[model samples]
Target: MTTTHATGTREEWLVARLKLLAVEKEFTRRGDELVQQRQALPWVRIDKAYRFDTEQGSVSLADLFRGRSQLLVYHFMFGPDYKAGCPSCSSIADGFDGIAVHLANHDVTLTAVSRAPLEKLLAYRQRMGWTFPWASSAGSDFNFDFNISFTEAQQRDGEVEYNYLRGRHAMDATPAPEPVVQFAANCGTDAQTYARDRPGMSAFVLEDGAVYHTYSTYARGVDGIWGMYQWLDRAPKGRNETGVWWKRHDEYARG
Candidate 1:
């Protein structure tokens, strides 16, 4: 049983909606300004020749641009020890393959970077049936350098640096929370193993034959790319979340 809202007459509803429309318009305009601000940020040159294991074999970070001037890497939470990707990250990736072609045509190459071994990544990619390019950062410092994946020692030190902050992660709890434990079990790993890996996205630009890191964002910053959340956010009831209520796309029960 849910509570109901007050009923309004047509005239009253119209007046209220018009007022809300003004606010919506202001929000959209602010969003446009933020986009420009992001573009204006400083770009850092990447000197290290970071290599990744891709379907096309070992390739440098610049190679990921794939002839495009820009590259976007979704830092997926699939660490070396986890048997599968984090469910939340998987949910966001579910929408990627659909938009990848459009991005490629627009001179932007969007891909997923994970710390899992190439074999594991390929197997899961096959299971998910995603055609978008995914590369492995295994045996590389790409994930660490980007500030997403953390080492066990970092976790034990009670200062897991993530989302641009150095602090104790929730997964650092001795037993962790029930949801974290369950998600780890789903990934065929323990809570600590799952908690150590965090999600993030990074942007790079290829200019004058050099790779420059343009931007990086984590946590809620990625909400916009999680297709399901974008839609759910617009629904009347909103996200309506209480706890971990999502799984890998195929894990849902079929009608």
Candidate 2:
């Protein structure tokens, strides 16, 4: 078949591949350094009592660790008004169940936290057939404090800060993007309600009977862990995305 992409002899391809390998190795080394820097960030002691509702019942933030010394919380975007979890977050979470056990064995508890009620979260988890832990922060300041959830007042005043930036998300635009509207409708809510919640992750450590927030990342800062994206990035087409082209795993048409 004819192609627009560059074509080359085996020898030429090998030359390019070797050069790319060198760059990839450098990138890998840089990523390692960044990981160390991330771990070096100062941790803020968590004093305010934050609670979450889980299958086990209402539990303190510290309890979410499940006896682990480190806690990793994925701030899922399932708002109280949504009929189901956000499809994008659901896609990201499709990889969690496989990794949660490995994380637990490594002294880390991996869980998802959302603003949706516990019942809603549990029902959705059942539908997805996920075994990883999920906790609801409904009526709690956990999401807001992490800057992944915004208040109506904050939205009204254009004070929504995300990914360490203020008033910059495409969702905050006057005419919401078509993908945002589509995702919101898919979740059974309007764009504004859907945008009220955002996606991110946070890390915490339990030390000397106190929990400390170590790091939190929002927006694309989370791309590194979105499993599907990592694989797509290595594929021949390399994402090749024109627009929103994903759905909850089950929503895809089966052959």
- What lDDT would each prediction earn against the true structure? 0.91, 0.93
Instruction: Give the alpha carbon lDDT tens digit for every residue of 46-95 in model 1.
Output: 99989999999999999999999999999998988898888999999998
- List of clashing residue pairs for candidate 1: none
Which stretches of candidate 2 lie above 4 Å from their native place? none
TM-scores of all predicted structures: 0.96, 0.98
lDDT of 2 at 191: 92
Worst 10 residues of 2 by lDDT: 165-174
Model 2, residue 51: C-alpha shift (Å): 1.1
Q: Please name the candidate that would achieve the greatest TM-score relative to the true structure.
A: 2
For residue 68, what is the lDDT in candidate 1? 99
- Note each model's CA RMSD in angstroms: 1.5, 0.8
* Per-residue lDDT over 180-207 for candidate 2, one digit per residue giving the tens place of the 0 to 100 score: 8999999999998999999999999999
Winning model by lDDT: 2
